[model samples]
Target: MANFKKGVALVLAAATAFTFAPVANLAPVTASAAATQIADATDLNLVLGETKSIKIKDISAYSIQNYTVSSSNKNVAYVTTTTTTGAAVSADGATTGASLTFNYSQVGKTFDIYAAGNGTAVITLTANNTNGAVVTETFNVSVNDKIEHISVKKTSDNSELSTAKPLTIASTDIKATPAASIKTNVTATVANRAGTTLKAVSDDPTIVTVANGTGNTFDITPVKIGSTTVTVTDTDAQDKILASYTFAVTVARADETLKVTYDSNRDGKNEDYKADSTNGHSKQGNAVYLDDDKTSFQIVAESALGRKITYTSSNPNAVSVDNNGLVVVSDKVKQETTVQHISADISVKTEATKIGTTTVPAAEVVVPVHFVNKKYTTLSVADAEGNVIAQTVNSPVDLADTNKDSKIDASDDAVITLSTKDKTSVNLVVASNAGDNFVSGEVFAPATNGKIGTTKSDVVTYANGVLTVAKTDITTDTRAFLVLEAKPSTATYGANAKITLQILVTTKNANNVIDVAKTLDLNASTKTATIAAKATYGNILKYELVEADATQADGYKAVAGNSNTDLSVNASTGLVTYKSKNSGSQVVRITGTSNATAVAPKAAYVTVNYSVKKNASDLAVAAKSIILEEGKTAAIGATASTAITYVSSDESVATVAADGTVTAVKAGSAEITVKAASDDKFDEGVVTIPVVVSKKAENTVVPKPAKVTGVKVANVKGAKVKVSFKKVSKAAGY
Candidate 1:
């Protein structure tokens, strides 16, 4: 029986070792040998009001007799245990009607650790094994406030406020005529603490007030015109003074009184009222010109805070006031026969007191206004020299209708047309001219509606009439008597007349005396010239053949050798042509006759002169041959009554210019020819000259020559004399 019992005990021991050893190898547990092993559990790190579950494991291969759970800081963190039977046990270690029971079946049980507040707590689990061994397990649990970040920002824009710098609220100007007020909202950001409320309080409520219970936002208003401080803190952590932000606020005082002024002219200057009892009108220092488009007066205030000014007009029909304190004279006042004086009241009130209970007195002033006529006149046309061009008794010059409307108006004042002679320019000037009631020192123009406009005038151009005549040379026979007759001679000449021609006898040669029996009448006004026709024995138009020389003294005949084929006589056209047979001057009388008897005919004569040229001869040159060195130029001496052309026979040796200057080309001889140009009075001639060019002399230094002691005359004849002198060595040729 002992052997059998020993065998059973050994088997039971092996079974226990095998069962518990595998469990221990699965998960390592730590505890005293006699105590129940507790599996290692992760520490709890949680936020406020958060819970974590820790699983309990037994690795000792022993049954758990009982278990108890407790927390070191119950207010910060709490612990509860659940047995394998599903019975819940609180930190005091009691279950529903009994104590917690634990064994191998409760190895997988769990203990729940809850975070009650922001602090650290240790949860201890004690379990006693059925073999009388006890094991304790502990876990550190941390509870943190849910807030992850904190910041302050403006509620309106959500802009973060700076913590490093004190927040400053802009001040208000309470002393201003109208006191200024300002307010703003600020909110705090508590991330992960969405339902938490923040509190904001001002250090000095007298200067600034912060409204509370407005969620995360607080309203900050300026209480008085001074400075104060405000602090914001988290209500949840009220005792944590380090987590608070303080800001500074300031309030400014504004001016107490507003200065108001009346600028009747709106020239930025105050005007004084002037009462005129006699005229039943009052003037505001200066007159408001009725001619100006802007005749309204303005009232201005000194302070922009209380700039609102009320303007009232006494006479609504004659004047009106606008919201901007501008007093405008009505059109009815402008159309009045006499000047009208207008009155207006301007008032401005000061700002309310600090408590908003009392009202400050307002400033009021009455301004008198006056209207005056701005006398102006129209524009007058003138020349560029400032000479006024107006209508006169003899000459009625009207202003130009520039628009072509056939009416003189304002648009025409800029430019005007004036009559001018050909090839001449006249400035059509326009200048300000005073009218019946002109105002001194005031400019006037047509476009200005009797107001000041252009101070200078512009110019316009007018073209002149051109005149031309049609006529050709006369070719006729010498024997025929040519009589010029004017066709359509009854025209006139003047500013509106056609151009006319006048003829007269300008010259008569010594040999001939032609008779003109009728008196020539040339009238420019009639555009006519006339010569009477003869009847019976009277010859009003006469042409007598005159001799050019004694050889043909009886009567000159046409020369057959004349090359002029256009010379002929046409008696029907009154055209005559004569070629002299001898070299002498002759005169012929030609009379012009008008087709109409009322038109006077003009008379004009012609004188014929001829000359005979000498026969051709050889051209002569001053020198037959010229000698020049290389690189030298000389003039070929030749003269003629007519123009002469020069030519070089050999340009390689020498060149001759048109003006007869000859340049030596090299050491050689050349022949230069001179020929006279064709002329009616001189015959053509030709001459030739020989030019010899020698080598240029070399430049060399020579000893000074002896000076001449005396000069003796060997022979003298008229202006020629032979002089002798002593010879010197190295002398240059003279």
Candidate 2:
């Protein structure tokens, strides 16, 4: 009994000692030691639609046994494991026997973990070593739906359309004699999102209607003359509203018209007339003419009724009437040498019986007429020197129609060719009958009568007539010069002697009134007397000869060539050259004793002054300063009386070429200089310009944080709650 108790006590004590021994003290046994424990762990981060790879380094002494992966949301994110020798395996926790395995030779190897998809998902990867040491890593993956942009366009014109106010339509267009409608369509474009539909709705269907069309298009139509609103909304497949727009529309009615009435005399008033009981007619004022030929008079057609009227002349040969009641003298009247007066009667008839009624004749109106004789006895032609070349019934003169209208009328230009070659200036002289007086020149119409119908002293030039003034040299000591002067300034006409100046200077500036410095008024007593020699010239002055007054002067008339009114000056030389048609001798003369005499007339001359300066020395620059960016170029524009040379102070900052092209090199300042080239006409000139160059901009990158996929509340307590989330990458700064 004593020996058994001692042995059991020894065994129990030995077993207790073995059980209490520390792990570090018993290291060198058989079998492999526990695989190296994972010393540190790291979570994963991924974006929506992005795949991330996690590399886990194995530091174990033995091969890995297995690795299992699980995900919180399989639809949002899933995991796959890849090894060096085997194909990748999906490890979403739903696959059976899905684990990564390593061989003995693959000890201390690394494995790849992949996570991909959209939305928030937690990926848990549990890895076990051959010795049963386990480690778990969680990865938070986030996926987002990014919307790039949205656009709306009109389907008709494909133009971007927006409205902040109401659009109006006319009721006449929509509700005319037949029903009409206005239609417009629009389309919406959603970018970076899928399965989106656009819908349109109207606030008042009675005023406007909206309907859907093919492929993101909507049509709107007008229904009535009222105001309404149309709303358009964009939505996704899940009925999530993305965008909405509204437009207001209005319809309006047409305008009304006013009443109409006749406005005689154009005085904006109506006049009334009464018919005589005995004569059945009303009398208007008499139509008068100076000669036996026809003449017209205007009669007021005033009435409340706007009706057409008819006109009738008693004698067609004496007078004729038109639809507007304008009576004209007939052209077929025989020319009577004896002075006499004639008469004609005109009547007017209306188509209205009463006011605003178109039935029987309303009334009859009569207009009286009178004519008288103003005849010419003799016609004569004279030259520029006031000498008679031909006379009516004496010279073999021919009356040809100058206008070629197939009729011999007053407008026809006469041709008088004498045996002499002096045909430059000519005039027509008509001697009136002793009792009758000549009317105004305006009364002579080409279609009225065959007479010349002009005064006895009217100037008439033959074909190709010209008038010229010869250049005369005059010297003076004063700086201001008198270029031209009219002599005598006065003249008289008589049977024994006649005095006149054939050529006269009328206007000095033509008709241009803008440039007072360049224009001269010949009618003014004082005028511009000097001009700079080096300044632009030639449109500064103009002159003309009074041909009509010259003919009446009794001494001179205009001839051919330069004597014609169509005269001009040389734009560059400021000189006048008069050319004659038959190249006849140009003469200016005063008349002595009757048509057979001649006298010398006083003349006119133009004078010019010379300047002391020889040339111009002006220098100018267009711009005083300019700003430019780096790497930009500009022209250093400068002007002088002569050519110039350009230079840059600092070529590295801004370089200047020979053609004045300035190029900015970098961010700095420089000076540009321009100097005049050698020239005798102008003095030397120099100009300087400052230039600045700007620096280039620096490039910077800003990362966009990943959008939140989801959020959840946990550990809720009265007023506060704990928030958890699938975190984004730290590099994204969120």
Candidate 3:
């Protein structure tokens, strides 16, 4: 019994030792190691230039005070200075990028992170402890370099379509209007993150097609009138679709400013319309001309979109026109040496009324034709051009605007008006079929009625027809009749043709002013500008370059006949180029003569104040405002001579790349700024482009629970109780 008792006691002691052996070191109860976590980051996948927000929940022993966010590569994954809790602030400082906003210090402080570029980044949310140890939570950001937007530009102008707007090509009736001016090729641009080269494919080749060009540009040729999408993909990414752009080839129509061109050379084409020929297009201001024998010639629109041309005559008794543009002249032209005219009304009819006379073409599609008689006269008094100011008669005292165009032009006869009743002498150049002998002989001075208004006197004496318009015996509104006897020896007249002149002298008239509009800039791309000057009452001012000597080259003298190399003036076109640089301000004088020689007898001047200083040209941008939805992108239309850098004011809202591509992040506003680096030829320029970011139209809906089977109430204490339920798929909140 004693030994049994001892064994029992020993077992009991061993059991006791095992049961309460201080249970201390087996393992401490660790509650699964609670962690400091980011509640929103399951996986950090971001598009380049995109921004996202994260929350760092203060769990376990991690405190919220003195906590800061940082990125490993600020260029790739960047942190912003803005914050909701105002935890920390920085620029492109040691710990943060110069972008984004984050709210810190709260239990779950929000952290705004930006995928500024393409690459991987390690972002850490660190909390400082009293001890040297620290609590840190990290997120690895993966950014995909890809395309975001695609657009087109006119190769001639470099202007781009609006953001999200399709590249539209107006209709071209090419088959019907072969001479139509339409450009089919356009340059395409892809706004990308890492500038990965992309290939473009049109959904329908019959609508449009894309051909890859240099760099990130492509050539898109419109084929027809329809809408097609150009799918852009990264071939290096195994043909992954990056973005898509739309091309809407809209229907073509005739130009608003319709013009009817005369095919004067008896051909069905406008190849004979000389521009200074082969200079380019037809003389945009070509005067009307008709070959008397040039019947059956065509008259059509310089540019038409399947429209018809209709012809009618103002005076069918003088000249008649057919709908097919056939002109017939009648024998009503009695003046052999003088020029005469008959108005012809031409218009474009909407119906493709077969180029023949079946329908009447009227308003809606018509442009009032400004025409003059295309003539080769036997006798005329004109300027350097054959624009006859006065022609020898069989004229019925032609002093009025015969065409009733309100202004004095070539269609009007010459009437000398004196600014004052002073004895002013002038010269006249008579161009006639009469040889030099008849031009100098006693062919002029004789009057048919043998009087100046029933009185005989030398009110105006004629010496050589080239000079001597003597104003010794002149009065107000004086009329003189001078008859010329065309001698057979010198005159090209038929048998006994006589040319008569009805010279009228008038008094001073008010409102004789020349309105001058000139542009003078030395450092402009187009140093030359055609002076837009107008005379009183719409008389076209004739331009001439005045001559200057070598000494007065820069004397601001006229740039004609002179040896001035610093300037050039096109006599034909009043286009003046100011090429002088490093020179101080000088006045360039150009001859501004008026066509109303009777009113403006003396010469006039158009002065351009040429003050040119050589300086660097400033950079420029075409767009004023940029607006887009979240995740949408656009490009800044900035032009510069050197490399450009871009920055966004609020990277959380929008971000711009080095190439001026802008990406919208969240719903907010930002300023995208472009900076052009300074070089020898260009000044450093900075322009701020405003951007408005709108929330995307996408709606995210959480799913409803299928059944509330496990839902129950728990932890009932006082007035509060806890409710528990099974987590449902995609159920966001309780």
Candidate 4:
């Protein structure tokens, strides 16, 4: 029993046995020798993208107790279970890469672990029982490395169709070369089909640039039925390559049309139709029209012509012609004015239609010459050759048709009146007859009748025959007659031809008054006749006025020679007359002669040609006004000048010095005047002096020394000067 008890104790202590009692039976007891638990490590490996399953057999005698799991060193997987087993089932955890973790739990449960090579995880199966002892079994699982995926795509949005990869045309096959080390590779081959054509290029290859890259599509078009292939290669830096693609090429027809125009005439056309050549166009805008259709039309807007036209497009695209044959454009244009090279003609008309008809030509014409026959004077006619011809007999005495057109007019008629110096007058008649025809004619001192034409007789005629004067003349040698006529005919006549005539003596009645117009030309200084007028014979008192016409060089004037007339002139009639002949231009009055005398005595010593001065003698002085600007001093040697004394009426208005210097006192006019002293040899005269004192005086002084060292002093008695000098000192030596 003792042995048995010791053995039992040992059994209890050393043997792992269990005892049990049923009901009142024995209670179960299990003696477990403190198990020396053990854990071991199993290593696993997996590839990326590959799943691996690991069966972990419990090599340890004791079950693996619960323990921690870890995959701290790998990027592939996470621990699905921290323990081998529990109320939670053992898990074959989801993993990635080549590795994963499976940890121990209770002693009896199994745990699964998986890895995809790159997935590495560490699991320690720690054995744990009711005993305080614990152990861990570690498992290192990793998945194998693998190639996951391969794909190709454009980096950009790849939207532009023109730059996009080419599409297969008619199933073209193109070949490519790939890198040699690749286990799996893809390649492509492309060929243009016989009839297949590429899509219309959004952009031509010439314009859109293609970048260098692994894969790119180049589009091409083929001409006619042809096949062309392009090879593509994808390679690494070391010439290791991937798949490549090729595109087909096809050529297609493209069509477009354009229209343009040019200027027909470089001269700009105006927009305004009414504008003539004087107005011109300024600008031209050139444009082109593009059309897809083969048919084309053109519309040209010409700024110069201001016109727009539409027409079928010519090769040059300009509007060539209008509907009409007119080469000029129908549109109005501004243009310069010039004779048109057109078919239109021009004609001119005038009121005086014919040049050689009644209107005479400006050219010279021939005229006949004739003379009047008088009783006391022989008459004659002559041709241009100087041959004497008998007078035409009994021509009608119609002076009106002087131009020889058979028309009567006043221009062709000649009229006259007569007067005499002895207050005698006469009446006479004349006509344009066998003696007169030219536009102008001269008169002679005879009538066509057998009587002498006295100073009181006159005759006038034109183209018509003449009428004789019925006058009686005194049988005096001074008796004269007046005859008037024109050129004998409208034939050649000398300009200086003399018309000869004769007349009988005539007597004049002394009681008759005759007045005639005369002309006089006088020399301005002398009032003497340069040319004298014909003398008049008339009762001078009967002539109310003597009128003068200044239009002619020695114009006519009618003057009275009678002494019983007022000394008055009619300014409107340009007439001069007087109450008596003593007041006429030829009348004279007696006046005293003046003698000049010296005033101031000669200076201390001098000689001079001084103006002779006269005393202030009381005489008939004429009141006259004169004008001079301000600051003006007048030197009036004398009123009558020469040897006369002149004094201002009011010496205060202007002062007169002994030297005849008249100085203006103020701003006003003064008269220092006098009439000419009457002398039988000189005409009456008057003088006017005007003095105007302006703002300032302008004086010019001439200096004359009392005695000049080198110059010869002139007029020394009337001039004086003062000399000044600085004191002089003797030189040091002196």
Best by lDDT: 3
How do the residues 1-734 of candidate 3 rate in per-residue lDDT, one tens digit apiece? Answer: 10110110111111000011111122222322223343445446554455565655534343222345566777777665444356554433344233332222234545466667657977655443323334445567776432212234222211133234222232222222332223344444444345344566777887556787776555555454445555554333445434444444332322212345553322232432222113322233223334232222345543232222345656566556666655555555433345444444433333221111222122222222222232222345543344444453322122121232123232334443323334233345565554545443222322344332334334455555532335444444444444443332422322322344455444433235666644355443346677666555454455655543433412234544532556666665667776765343333343333343335533345555454433464678887899999999888878877787888999999988877889999998999888888764455788888999998896877666466558889878898989887876765444
Looking at model 1, which ten-residue stretch has the lowest summed lDDT?
477-486
TM-score of each: 0.19, 0.19, 0.26, 0.16
Question: Which rank order by TM-score, best down to worst?
Answer: 3, 1, 2, 4
Tell how far residue 156 is off in model 2, in angstroms.
99
For candidate 1, give the lDDT: 0.44
Candidate number that wins on TM-score, 2 or 3 = 3
The regions of model 2 sitting more than 4 angstroms off are 1-624, 637-642, 649-653, 665-670, 682-688, 707-710, 713-734
Mind giving the per-residue lDDT tens digits that candidate 1 earns over 1-734? 10111110111111100011122222223444344435445455554554556666654354444445567777777765554467565653233223443345445756566667667876655544444555555567776432211122222211143243232333222221222234566655554443334677887887677897566677776654456666776534444332355655555433223444554333334644422222222223333322223457665544322222455666666667675666677777666655343443333332221212223233334454544322212333444566554311100011122222223233332222111122122333332323212211211122334222333212121222111111112121001000111111112100111111111111111112224433322111111222223422222453333324323312244333222432333333333343333344434335333222211122334443333434354456777788999989998778777788999989989999988899998999989989986554356888889899999989987666578756788658788889887776666532
lDDT for each residue of candidate 4 in 132-218, tens digit (9 for 90 to 100): 344333455554322212122222221123233333223332221111111212222223212222222312343122223233333
Q: Which regions of candidate 4 fall more than 4 Å away from where they truly are? A: 1-41, 47-66, 73-75, 81-108, 116-119, 128-134, 148-734
Backbone N/Cα/C clashes per model:
22, 20, 10, 130
- Please identify which of the two predictions, 1 or 3, would achieve the higher TM-score against the true structure: 3
User: Model 2: how far is 232 from its true place, Å?
Assistant: 99
Give me the displacement of residue 40 in model 4, in angstroms.
8.5
- Which residue runs does candidate 1 get wrong by more than 4 Å? 1-181, 185-198, 203-208, 212-217, 222-229, 234-239, 245-254, 257-370, 373-734
Model 3 stretches astray by more than 4 angstroms: 1-185, 188-195, 233-259, 263-319, 322-324, 331-428, 431-734
